[model samples]
Every structure is written in structure tokens, then in C-alpha cells.
Target: MEFKMKTEGFHIELPYGRLDISGNEENGFRPYQLLISSLAVCSGGILRTILTKMRLKVDDIRIIADAERNPKIANRIEKVSLHFKIKGSHLSDEKIAKALELTTKNCAMVQSMIDSIEVCKTYEIIDS
Candidate 1:
């Protein structure tokens, strides 16, 4: 994989895509997208690990991610929102909530992002 960043402009190019390295306030999808995705994957990974340890049977798991950007001169991502839908049976609400909490706490991506910015999360439990 190759990566390149412009010194003058706030743009960066990756092997697959280009990003605004300088936090382009005028453009879209700055470096923050990568950070946000990191959180999503991290949380998912953590939850998977915890559930496996607890032997909870999961039918399906999906995470929907979105972010709110601040369109100012050095535009930055201000807020990140996560919506999670979990499909599992024979699991208590408390156990699921605990797993979610632990996932947020342990996920390095979420943990790092939360320290510098605000991240919101909501979950839905589905019987399957």
C-alpha cells in the first residue's frame, strides 16, 4: 500500500482513495473518516470477542456508522454516531449492555477517539 500527502494543500492520496490530510474545511471526507471507521471496527471486534467468551449465540451483527462534520475554516469532524443492531437469542439485556459497554471501553479506536472528541452510540436487540 502506498500513501502520499501534499505539503501545501490539505489532501492525501492512498493506494485506494484520497483524503484531505490538511483537514480541508471546504472539501469532503478528511482524515477523520479513517479514524471513525477505526472505531467501528474496533467496537465490533471487541463485542465479537466478548460474546464468544460468554458463549452467546449471535445470529447476526451489524453496525451503521455516521459522522457530523464542522464546516469551518480548518474543518474537523465534531461528532460521530454509531447505531448497532444485534441479533442473538437467549441473552439477557443486562449482559448485552455490559458487553457493549466493555466494547466501548476496550476498543482502542473508540477509546482514542473518545478522548479527543464526542462519540454517540445506540443499540437495538433483535430476537433471532
Candidate 2:
């Protein structure tokens, strides 16, 4: 991917559309936002797939990510907390926990950040 410099930030042309990235939020999407979003979506997608494979009827899945950044160290991300709100049928706490474990183990984004970023996951099951 090539990033072309704009007046305020850099923009990359993807197949779907253009993505603008910048340090300032008003200019474009922040780098940290994209990083956390990538990790959150990757794990969420994996968890959804795992639940489907387990034959759980899923209506929807929503993931919320909270990232802790250390200002002392170039504002680097230290940890990420992910909360998943899942609306489904026949879901048990035990099964959801196991599915989350599997998701953490298998998610490429989580694996990639294992050495540097601390990732924590929690979930709530909503009746659908």
C-alpha cells in the first residue's frame, strides 16, 4: 500500500475507498484508533466464526475496545481491553469463555501484539 501525503495527513487508496491517517483527529483517522480497531475487529470476527462453528444461533455481536496509551513513551499503546456484547440463543457462560479463549489463541492480530501489547477480553451474552 502506498501512502500519499496530503495537506494535513497521508491518504492511502484501497480497493474499497481512500483512508486518511493523521496524528490529529480532525485531519483524519488517528493511528492509534486504526491499530486498536484492527485488533478488535480481528478478534471479534474470529469469535463470531467460532460461535457459528459451535452451532450457536447468533443474532449480533458488538465489540468495544479501550486502549491505554503511555505518554512517557512516545504515546505508545500499553494495553487494550475488549468488551463483547453478544446477542444470541442457547449461549452459556462456559461456552462463551471457551470461545473467547480460542479467539485469543487464533487471532492473528492478537498473536502479533502478544509480545508488546497486553490484551484483555470480556463478554456479555444478551438474549435474542
The model with the greatest lDDT is 2
In candidate 1, stretches whose alpha carbon ends up further than 4 angstroms from where it belongs are 5-30
Q: TM-score of each candidate? A: 0.74, 0.97
Per-residue lDDT over 64-120 for candidate 1, one digit per residue giving the tens place of the 0 to 100 score: 999887788456777888888889998778888888888888888887777666888
Q: Rate the local accuracy (lDDT) of all candidates.
A: 0.78, 0.96
Q: Where in model 2 is the C-alpha error above 4 Å?
A: none
**lDDT at 62, model 2:** 93
Q: What is residue 10's positional error in candidate 2, in angstroms? A: 0.6
Poorest lDDT segment (10 consecutive residues) of candidate 1: 1-10
- Supply the TM-score for candidate 1: 0.74
Candidate 1 global lDDT: 0.78
Looking at model 2, residue 126 earns an lDDT score of: 99
